[model samples]
Target chain A: MTRTSTLSPVPPADAAAEPTRVAVSTVIFTLRRLPGSETASVALPLVRRTRDPHEGLWALPGGWLDATEGLDAAASRTLAETTGLAPSYLEQLYAFGAVDRSPSRVVSIVYWALIRPDEIADASDENVQWFDAASLPGLAFDHNQIVDYALWRLRNKVGYSRIAHGLLADEFTLAELREVYEAILGRRLDPANFRRQVENSGTLIPTDRFRTGSHRPARLYRYNQDVELADRGPLDRRQ
Target chain B: MTRTSTLSPVPPADAAAEPTRVAVSTVIFTLRRLPGSETASVALPLVRRTRDPHEGLWALPGGWLDATEGLDAAASRTLAETTGLAPSYLEQLYAFGAVDRSPSRVVSIVYWALIRPDEIADASDENVQWFDAASLPGLAFDHNQIVDYALWRLRNKVGYSRIAHGLLADEFTLAELREVYEAILGRRLDPANFRRQVENSGTLIPTDRFRTGSHRPARLYRYNQDVELADRGPLDRRQ
Candidate 1:
């Protein structure tokens, strides 16, 4: 995409002095098996700030928006650059622009993304570390609130969208699928109900393959790619 | 509400030359009776741009984001300043920051709002006029695409939220409530099913008042104040 440089033929004299910097941030959630817990819990990666303002504090992985890239592209670039992680399911969360949110006027176009557990290997950055989304420390700026909102969106979208598929493998047992939901929702769901509900939704394709577990072999199912992970509606275009 | 001057302690010398100006805009929806239609249709106020970069074209009511106000406050201020309407239901829509969206880079923190028909009397601005949202002409910037996204959000949220209540007065009949949905969804709905659904949802309360229409006296129902108009979840606080 080509970038537009200036607003007017004769630019405002004070534009440079009061430029509103645009930043792109992401809340990347993945399920990590808790230390001694039987089930996994939702976790996200945060990067420690290196500069002043909130230096040494943890914040969402992000960077300044490049002039030539679209918002989605900018988000993907930032996510990849900071944590070396790519998201499976990415959606714009919110535009946080409180006057006092930053030391300078900064508008963050926050995107929430879902990363599969297997893709978490790239989080080898020294400044990057995974933390339980539920028990996060005091983060830089309004990041704590931003994560809370992203978590809310994740839980809310999981109910109606096939977003849980983003956190799972290509094929998984019903038990595995339920585990993802349980981890994010922090609740135990009835297996029978979940199975019936997913089956009735027609978004899952039951496969002949089975996962051999300690107790029994369970049927594996793959998500129907025809169904979108999230309903973006009219704004589904890549732009 | 104090504004931060700049982001860095030592301001970038070329900040104005490569500035990311922030703009605030709103898509305020209200029900308007069509010329001959029996039911009201979804309508929104549009402003005629008098400046370059799509001059003389109709656009969403908006203004440059002030450095001193919160996003929600900026949206409310712009909505009132340009269109002279205050939204009963106001929610962040999306941030549109495509590189080539304008002659200059503008990150618009767009908001979609709902105003009751009774509140539209404040819309006396000559440059601001109401238009059928379903058949809007070409708009300024990427506003056409922005409106499409907002319309989608409106239709999608109408299914799960009490946003329709924003288009109605405190006391309204079941038929009145159903009309708002039908207008927004652009389809007919079974009155019986809608009544049962809204009744079971427990978002409305039956009042002793009744609207004595030409046919029959339909009982007037008032929206349950205890229930929120929309489920913002964890971000319900007015940031």
Candidate 2:
């Protein structure tokens, strides 16, 4: 494309700046059982950048968006290519386009995804490593801020939506479910309060199956299939 | 820039497709009083396109994003340029990048803004016009879908956050505040129930001033300065 075609809307004075490029990145979160800890914690995989603009620093798994693909498709592609894992739940988080975010003029359309522990496949490699979302090191670009925002969104969504089901199995005891919430919230919740709240929410369906634990025999529950995991409005159809 | 620089991350075959351009657009919603109506309706300004690709059709006020500007800055700049109105609240809504959304490969970082009825400025011109957001005609590109999502978000957010205050003035009666909610919700709310809910939320501060109406004088109230209009997570710092 000539300078006049794509750059027509931009004035000649502003045209001297490089054209803005688009990139797709994903903050994939999952429940990981940390060593010496019974409760799970939120964790995400990061790719160590080999090139400048913060070489050797960990960054979100992403790549430049291919013009032929849609934004959602690009997010999924880049995530799978970089992390070698496919997430169960993915949603667009935000578009970060701070001029100083990267060396080049680029806009990153960041997506946050949720992976069920059962589906996490071969995530850690030589260049890729999983880090606790809360205790992440200095990441490349503005990724630390991005991860914080994603974690906030995850915790916020868990309160009103049925998103916590993405972290658990098809059927689990209430205690297990409570653990997921406690992990994401980073605090212990009153078991009685958690049970009453989940029951009132009406998103859970109690199953006849039971899990016999050391404390007591607990009933297993599954998410109501009729209800969506999260309400993403009209754009959820693509997902 | 060489073909290997910005487009390097994309494969040679994928790079054959045109490099995507970033554009910033805003759905600036404001409450406008209609003729022969007591309550206001949600309305937004649209610019009539004068070039090909849905020429003569109405579209959201926007322009191609300049690389030198950040996403938020571009949104504010393009919004002010296309529509001569500055809004009270503006937040990033979503990033729309469906391959078929436009004739050219364009990814629009859409923002939804709220304008208080008092701060609305001269908005009508030969090319730009305000249309009822609920009953908009066929718009250019994928703007109709974008507007629907924004309206959905506005309604959903009002249920949880104090964002409805953005559409209100500094001080208002319970009846006036209810009208703003009723207008955006497109339905009447129980007056007593609405009062009890907002009061219980602890976000309002009753003032000495009152609105003397035909029925009874109702006390006015202002938003609690300590509470933010909306909880935008860490990104709230930017706004």
User: Could you tell me how far off, in angstroms, the CA of residue A222 lies in candidate 1 after the best superposition?
Assistant: 2.0
lDDT (C-alpha, whole model) for all candidates: 0.79, 0.78
lDDT of 1 by residue, A1-239 (tens): 11111223333446344666888899999889977989889999988887778888888988777777888998888787777777755788899888788898888899987878887775445788889998999999999999998888888766423644788888988888898889888899999998899889888899899999686999989988888777888884566
> What's the i-RMS of each model?
9.1, 7.0
Give per-residue lDDT, candidate 2, residue A40.
89
Candidate 1 segments whose C-alpha is farther than 4 A from its true place: A1-16, B1-16, B159-161
Sliding window of 10 residues with minimal summed lDDT for model 2 chain B: B1-10
Compared with the true structure, what per-residue lDDT tens digits does model 2 show for residues B112-155? Answer: 88887677666446777889988999998899999999999988
Expressed as tens digits, the lDDT of each residue in A1-239 for candidate 2 is 01011213323445334457789889988888977987889889888887677877889988888877888888888887777777755788999988888888778999987778788766446788889988999988888989988988888866423654677788888898888888899999999999999999888889999998687799989888778776778774562
Worst 10 residues of 2 chain A by lDDT: A1-10
Indicate the TM-score of model 1. 0.91
